[model samples]
Target chain A: MLNKIKRILIELGGIHRFVMRFFRELVRPPYEFKEIIKQCYEVGWKSLPLISLTGFITGIVFTNQSRPSLAEFGATSWLPALISIAIIRALAPLVTALIASGKVGSQIGAELGSMKVTEQIDAMEVSGTNPFKFLVVSRVLATTITIPILSLYTACVGLLGAYLSVNQHESTSFVVYFSQVFEAVSYLDIFSLVLKAVVFGYTIGIVGCYQGYNSSKGTEGVGKAANWAVVMSMFLIFVEEILIVQIIQGMRT
Target chain B: MVNEREHIDQHTKVITVKGVSKSFGDLDVLRGVDLHLFKGENLVVLGRSGTGKSVLIKLISGLLKPDTGTIEVLGEPVDELDEKALQLLRLKIGFSFQSSALYDSMTVRENLEFPLVRNKRHLSRNEINSEVEDVLDAVGLLHTIGQMPSELSGGQRKRIGIARTLILRPEIMLYDEPTAGLDPITCIEINGLINEVQEKYKTSSIIITHDLACAKSVGDRIVMLLDGSFERGGSFDEIFDTNDERVKPFYDYNFII
Candidate 1:
């Protein structure tokens, strides 16, 4: 048990240094804009279809689930505001992050793990290119920039789903439904959403890169790297979600 | 038993590793190993698997650090240089890995163009293409330039790997198992390529291999690495014409002597 704790602490220390090195390398000259653009396309554009479907489903389900609860209280009119607050402030970012943690995290982990085991990373280093800057920074920046946008898109799609659900019950107009939605969502909720998106995205990128870059030898190590990347990213995102909510609470107070 | 050539000129030495020792955990891979490479010669480090032949080259190329002692390459101490300085030094040294280490995602053309595009931004697209084609032609693999590395055979991949390194025209080439897992015909072809690169590019090289045939074909000087340190150093025949227990097994396995 003591040895297990020691290993965990050592791993955490390594991750801390790896993340610090990422920032140090990030600020250095000769940034890789082309690779960053390529990763943005990969992280954002490629993920759009799945994210859209998820957002729409979450919106419809949340609205349906809450309608009966509000009806019991004779407060069905409050459905849009409630759904909007919940989706934008919490569900949209969380759901989108979870999806990205599975998709993008696994891809980075597996790709880099293969590269590491094959000696391609060493080859890149010897060839006069900083593989960390070329691989890690570009990927992390892509996730950081793209995940917020993806989250915002998910929120908008989710609201549309909610609107559709409300119209099914009472012929509520789209503009009215949206107005009610926006009225309940404050600057703090949106701020919180964006903060969560950035943090979640950065966590996913760093965890995946760290796992892959330092991946052990052989195919088994690559498989473990990809698997752990998803698991760890999701865990960190949930933990960050709770903390960010507390931060928003402090802001409200 | 060591029967090295009597004529040693210190001025021609391109790489000098003195008292270098490296270890991982409790496993000591190289212990107080002293070696050197002269300009414009292929020095083969022959060893069985896990004898740290690849580790020695990696240390020379600045990919790995040693626990103790110094490594000097092209008149600069490898361990002392910072990142930028190390990168600058790396441009002068080309390391061809055992697995070929080709970027599988990239086409042969892009793979060839990669080192150039990164280091020589001043070159035009046409100039880069010309350089890539020229090196590919030299390696006799210009036909495979449009394909990805995965599409190529093991031998083709190895040639492309060498061509990729040769594109930089590095002064010192470190080849790690250049013919480890290939047919005899392809091994002979790779051997010819190594000698061709040595002649055409005028590059000093340290070819690390367990294959005695590869050592005999391209090696101007041969050193056998056993239990982490060099146990023999001389001509291929001189090193192997021995009854020493550590050296005879390699000779017995390869030749009919």
Candidate 2:
């Protein structure tokens, strides 16, 4: 068992070195600027509608569900503040990530997964292009930039949805609601939310690419890549959330 | 048998593999395999499944490093080149994958544009457009440019894969079973196109395939790989007519009167 564990560790280290070498090659080279732009559109901007719609529903449902519970404590007036902080700092990015895991992550995994199964990645390398930089890095960078933007957009839409939900019960001005929400929010919450989205983006991008990139067997391997990506990325996102929450709680105290 | 590496060098050959061996754990895929790929020559590599044909071509193209051996592609040792150097070397080589391998998300044009986009070979939109159109014309797929790969016929996709490689104007072309899954008619057409590309571009090619028809039709020289090495290398006719003990059975199995 000990020897087996050692072998696994050695293999993982080799993979780490391999991945890092690819990254080093990626940043230095003849960069694919236009392709990167195209990927940004595909991975980031095009995903806006789906992400935004999900965000709206999440915010509306969350506010409506929490309203009765808060009213029991007669804390209903703090609804705007509560919903605002929750949506912007926690729910928006988290929910957006989940949605992206389903949408963008799967798309990336399937796209690359198919490419690998087809020997297209090998073709790229043979043709004198770094597959990692030309394909993986460009897509990953696109996700990093795009996911946060998508998250911010989601937060905005979600806030609007929460406003509608709150207004359904009691009248409230947009200005007063937004002001109260923003007032209750800290710089830390905003920064941390953005930071978390970045991490989520990285997690999704890396896992999706990793699974597809290393997939060896054949046809069903691509499917396995997409499956493993979703599973691994979701786990990482939740774990990071817990870590982020603990750090935030520590900061507050 | 003499090793092919002794006679080849930077000037005489475009690719040379010396004392190359690769293995997966206990299974040795290639053992002391030595071969030479000369410029503007069509070298068809024939082998049964699991004979390491794919692995050999991949090693030449620097996709997988050999466990122990030296690979010189376009005069530079593949193992010694940095990523940037390797990328530059790759630009000079075009590879057609067995499965067409078109980027599923990208349209045919985007798939063809992939390598060009990296090299930025064309400065303006008109130039890129013209080049893409020219290659598409060559492959007889000017109309399929707008369609996604998923929508195309298998033959159409394979043609697009060829067109993608042509966009680079590579010095060497490596094809991994270009006609493996195609119908007979499609196979003949692809074989014809492969020949046309070789004649027109004057680019050295290494075609890896198990299909004997493809080898007979398109290969200038057929190299049969068996038992982890090249068992036979000769002109297509010599390969067909030779009475060499190992060559006779395979030739008889595939060759028609």
Candidate 3:
């Protein structure tokens, strides 16, 4: 047991060193600015349709389900505040992260995994290119920058969808609904969701790249890398969420 | 420093690999392989399957590090340089992959322009334009310059690969199975282009191939690799005419009449 733990610790230490070196190589000269922009579009902007669809429907479903319970309390007017808190502080970032873990994580993992097997990465190395910095760094940077934007966009659209759903039954104005939402949401709520999204982004990027960069064997390895990327990233996000919620509650107290 | 090392000088040998060996776990690929490349010489390494010819070119290009020994490119110790320094060195060496390895997402122009853009300061836009155009023309793919790799034929893609490598105007050119899978006509076309490019640019070249026709056509000196080492090497005539027991079978396999 002790030996197993020792091996795990050593592996973790090696990965930590590699990540630091990745960051260092990432920022130095011979920037792949074009590649970065291209990846940002490929990984980030392209997925807006799916992200928007999920966000809107989720908010609509949540509000519709909660309406009957609130109606019993004669507090149907509390719908906007209730839905906004649920969507922004809890559902939006977490669900967006889950979706992205499947989408971007698998994409990155498979792409790098294939490159590794085909010796394309080796080609870059021989050509005197920093494969880690040029390939991994650009990807990590793109995901880190874009995921938060996705979370914010999803949260806003989700609230709009909920407001519209609520309007299908209640006769409230858009102004009244938004004011209640703003009033109910505190700075802490905003901070927590944004914080979760950032962590989710980092988790997805790191785990995906790790799987792809270190993959072995052959064609089957690419699929394995993609599969592991999603599985590991989703698991990490949930684990992170648990710790973050506890830390946030402790800070509030 | 850049201009002086742009091409080979008769006085200065370009690439020197001394006692290089590499292995994957228990499988030792290259063992004690040493070779010298002069300025403006075409050196072809020929061998049967699993002979480590490709491994030799890769090590010289700093793609793979040797388990032991030294590789000096343009007098710089390649084994000692960091990743950044290695990339700088790569900018001076151009490689053509057998599979073409063109960025699939990019058009042919973008694929060719990629190394040029990355190494931007070396040449101006007009210079890059003419260089790309000239390279495309030299490879006889001037018409497909706007198409993506996915759109091109197998032969056409390889030609684009040649164009991409030429954009860098490398001092040392490495070809990994440059004509491996093409049709016979395409194979001959690629071989002729390889020779023409070497002469036109005055670039020293190291070509790895199992194709005897390619080896004979492109090689100024032919070296045969076998049993984890070089078995025989000489000028084309010396390699073909010699009747040594080990060397005779190779020519016989090619059905040389």
Q: Give a tens-digit lDDT track for model 1, residues A1-253.
A: 9999999999989998999999999999898999999999999999999999999999999999899889998998999899999999999999999999999999999999999999999999999999999999999999999999999999999999888999999689998998999999999999999999999999999999999999986999999999999999999998999999998999999
Model 3 over residues B10-53: C-alpha lDDT tens digits? Answer: 57678998888999879999899888888887888888778888
The most accurate candidate by lDDT is 1
* Residue B102 shift from truth in candidate 3, angstroms: 0.8
**Model 3 misplaced regions, further than 4 Å:** A1-14, A30-32, A71-75, A123-129, A216-218, B1-11, B240-250
**Ranking according to TM-score, highest score first:** 1, 3, 2
lDDT of all predictions: 0.93, 0.83, 0.84
Q: Tens-digit lDDT track for model 2 on A79-186?
A: 999998888779988988888877778778878888888777877776656788878888777777788888989999999999998887868888888888899998
Docking quality band of candidate 3, CAPRI definitions: acceptable
Fnat scores for every prediction: 0.83, 0.83, 0.41
Q: 1 or 2, which is superior by lDDT?
A: 1
Each model's DockQ? 0.87, 0.67, 0.44
Clashing pairs in 1: none
Between candidates 2 and 3, the DockQ winner: 2
Error of 3 at B255 (Å): 2.5
Q: In model 1, what is the error at residue A234, expressed in angstroms? A: 0.8
Name the top DockQ candidate: 1
Query: TM-score: which is higher, 2 or 3?
Result: 3
Candidate 2 scores an fnat of 0.83
Report residue B193 deviation for candidate 3 (angstroms): 1.0
